[model samples]
Target: MPSKRVRYPFQVLALCLSAWGLAWAGPPAEKDKAPDAASIRRGKYLATIGVCEACHTPPAVPAVPGGGDPDRERLFRMDPDWVRYLDPQRQLAGGVPFILRLSGTTHGLVVTPNLTPDVETGLGSWTEDEIVEVLRTARRKDGRVLFTFPPHSFYNHMALEDARSLARYLKSLPPIRNPIQPRTLPFEPQPMVADGPARAPQGRTRERATYLMGALVGCRECHSHHENGTLVEFAGGSPSDPFQGSFRLGPDLPLRQLEKGFAAFPYPGFAVLYGSNLTVLGHGGALERVPTERIVRAIRQGIDVREDEYGRPRPIAHVMMWQFYKDMADVDALALADYLKTLTPVANPVGVRLKLFGTDWEAAFQQTYGEPPTPEDRAAFGMP
Candidate 1:
């Protein structure tokens, strides 16, 4: 019998296709599995702790005028209820612009994006893999870099699994079609603020805490002081409580003397609250003195401390929602505490920096707010 020519059809086809600059087509790749309910729920909780709404939610229709300008308002009016009761539909459909003012000059702008799942406007087009890419690399799916969000730094310390959990959760949100315009802004560049060394530094516990406190829990907003004239302010806490007469010694107090001592003012000038000097370590700051248990309580359940508003108490100056952080993992809480202890003890007091140093409120209005707002203007802003 003649030798049979064994036909290697598959091999020959592969070779031919390779030579022709293409591979034989195979079945279409499978899509990623959708996140389960459990994952989505987990992500929702994480988002809350991160205070994602602070930068993401469109500013509420203020009871005051000028609601059109979202930037000219306190974050969620510093109202714990306002933040907690955000509209679910518009939640994460971001268009809020956060302006960082220092010494009376606009230092930078941070306008967030809509995080909803809307196909045309939000994260609906995103996959979990893209989420992972952002948390890990700070790069967009299309190859652009993300802005310097608090998450951008600490998430680098997060576990892939946790990052995945966050991604899964975000992807699972109900789609909303709110169109957020371009979020970038034109402002003076500020120096990069490093989150400092890892808060945990040892086990799976390491980095987890700092991510929550420094990035997620958001204490740095209230628990910090500016160096070389940086704006130092926090949500839900104001120093000068006009109602209670608790106006503390600060720059805008009495004579606009630019005195430092943890200064803060609500939008539209409702109240001026001061943040506690957090970097001093022992006397007032809890870092070297307070027990971890107490610190944890303060983080999860608010303390009963009070600030003065015209010499009367007004719900601790502004509403602080520690309950949102109730479910923090134990390891993460410890991590947050550890990070808190590591805040390089800055002896300086907290104060807001305005454009014209040592100028009175009237000049400040023209220099900072433009054309001194009247009592109606202030009330219209719902701050006073």
Candidate 2:
């Protein structure tokens, strides 16, 4: 019966302090050092594969058409033009503002967050392990996981080597001292379901190509935009926004305007065309139409369908695919050609509803097809 007065709270406090002290003693010994130049270069390459700049960089305006600005202070700022059209007050992005458009409609704009290593506002304090954990796990502050990293899924099907390299590269970038506000989703955060372990596909060339296309190059992300202009999945239904469709690259430009010794060309001057369905119905369709040999020739030779001044298929712009594909040893271009042929056309109509009007279609259906029983009907049955 020594000191029967409640010592429970004090005991709890002491335990908490003891735990804190242990944690503060410093992280368990591990070799955490700055990555080497080769690792950094690998990281840079992986970052390109993920097309990290696309979201991190602000939308390109007429003043800055290509959207390549590296200035951190202005990075990831919501496009002013888009803000004017959507929210006049422009409340989000300065802080965690409620995003009304995302939930109210099928399509909505999501302000991308800044990833620069700014101490006050950016990820400057994040350790390499923390960064790796974020990409690998997709966890929120409360320890809930996210379904997808909307717009661009860098972690979606991401290879471990590539993820690590990208993380290292991000850490190495010169810290841009900009404090971007956090992103706000329309709905309350839903806990993320953990997908299975990442599997690197077999076949070196196929694996590398898939990594480039899926994680790094991000062909699917660019081609797929939700009706609200967000790039959620490879659903490929994003509307024509500011940068939705500005450049076209292929064998289909007016010949006279084409540059010397080139068949395929990049048409940046054309009216902004919404991204064509990359499925079997669109450009992927064209690729399927040709033989693997022709496909290889088209990429490596850059030959336009039309002839050059020398009466040969003029070499078009150097397709980077040719260079990348050349290094691929597996399946050759035929396998890629075959794979491109397999892309299914998205059956959903494009531009059916760019903006939602908020009508309750379900209620309308019930009224027309199955009306609720009237009070008289219930009374006749002696029902309460």
Candidate 3:
């Protein structure tokens, strides 16, 4: 004998609203709001400087009628056509595979995902907060951790505003219907915390440069020395003292030994490349010897024009990500160069085995340096 429950009129109204998928949550959070025009523009600028398109956009085939495969290569590449351009239709619709290698071992390939706003295939369902979280933590909501390819480590503590703007820009893109496969890791990705609090850059030029190189552009990922595994926080470094250089692909031998000479690298024909010392500490450091104009040229042109022992400019190895920086604005590139002159010096002499230009690199190199290397020049660099 239970009294019949009496529902209030308000409760009935609430039930009706819930049934209609219109439950009142007061108001949508700021993160859920549609971005304004200024916000979208700022986001686009940030994405361009971050070179998101370099890794996210698939390449276009010049000869193909309709077009070629979308996911053929990762990063920018020189096709048989010798001209490289991102497919406008598939912009940021990532489907390329980035091979993950350690020392000489191949772990697996990490496929880039569609960043467009496609409801089913891309990030359309993701909230701005979710996108910001991935930028700040390198860990997605699904628990998958991104390593290296995205350089999320450097982006982990970027200014909150900049990160949010970047997210807004990504969400504003036209929805592309590319579906990306999930990545399988050879080892578990460890959870990461920022080395320090997330601090916004001050108005000073060096501070802005710090935020630009360390966070947005990720110059430190390759230039700084790392301890533990490749996924750990950079060791013995701070924002102002990045660029200490690493031995991962460097010649570990002393200067004299390197001069006395060593055999060709273990990987026959492959260049032994390393992040060169950009600080003003060692004999090989760029700050002391290289002019700021030269640094700007290197950043914009990809050729280290600092004459080698052979009295010729060296074409930086492809791994340097110079292609991404080629389009950087002059003011920012100059700021980065000027800032490098003020770094706390760290003595790390790097031995970079320059790569010989191949037929594939012919047109691209010509476009950059005005012409391809002469036959004698190729033989001088040990290319057959």
C-alpha TM-score for every candidate: 0.57, 0.47, 0.62
Give one digit per residue, the lDDT tens place, for model 2 in 26-134: 2322126545555556566444333343334432221232334444213222221111111112111121111111111221123334455566655667765556556
Native-to-model Cα distance after best TM-score fit, residue 80 in candidate 2, in Å: 19
lDDT of 2 at 353: 22
List residue ranges in candidate 1 displaced over 4 A. Answer: 1-31, 34-38, 59-80, 99-110, 149-154, 184-207, 226-274, 279-291, 304-323, 329-331, 338-346, 349-384
Candidate 3's residue-wise lDDT over 1-384, tens digit each?
A: 211111100000000001111121222246556565565665676676676765677545322322445444211222211114557788888765443322122234455689999988899988887887788877776787775433555677577666766787888889999888676556656555644234345433676777787678766655655333242221222222212222111111001101211111111121223455566522344346667788788776777747668989877644455555665666677777777666656654333333332334343223222345455433322234
Q: What ranking of all candidate models by lDDT puts the best one first? A: 3, 1, 2
Model 3 residue 370 distance off true place after TM-score fit, in angstroms: 36
- Candidates in order have lDDT scores of 0.44, 0.36, 0.51
- Name the lDDT value of residue 101 in candidate 2: 18
Residue lDDT tens for model 1, 1-384: 211111100000000001111121222121255335554555566666755654566434442344345542334433333444345557677655433222232233344667777889888888776776676666777776654544344456554444555676677667778765453333322223333332223322545654455444546545443333443422122222211112211222110111111122222232233345444443345347756665566566665333245654333323234545565555556666655555545444325412233424444433333245465434322224
Regions more than 4 Å wrong, model 2:
1-31, 59-100, 103-110, 140-156, 191-199, 202-274, 277-338, 342-384
Give the least accurate 10-residue stretch of model 3, judged by summed lDDT.
8-17
* CA displacement after TM-score superposition, residue 133 of candidate 2 (Å): 2.4
Candidate 2, residue 78: CA error in Å? Answer: 19
Ranking by TM-score: 3, 1, 2
Choose the strongest candidate by TM-score.
3
TM-score of 2: 0.47
| Clash number for each model | 30, 12, 0
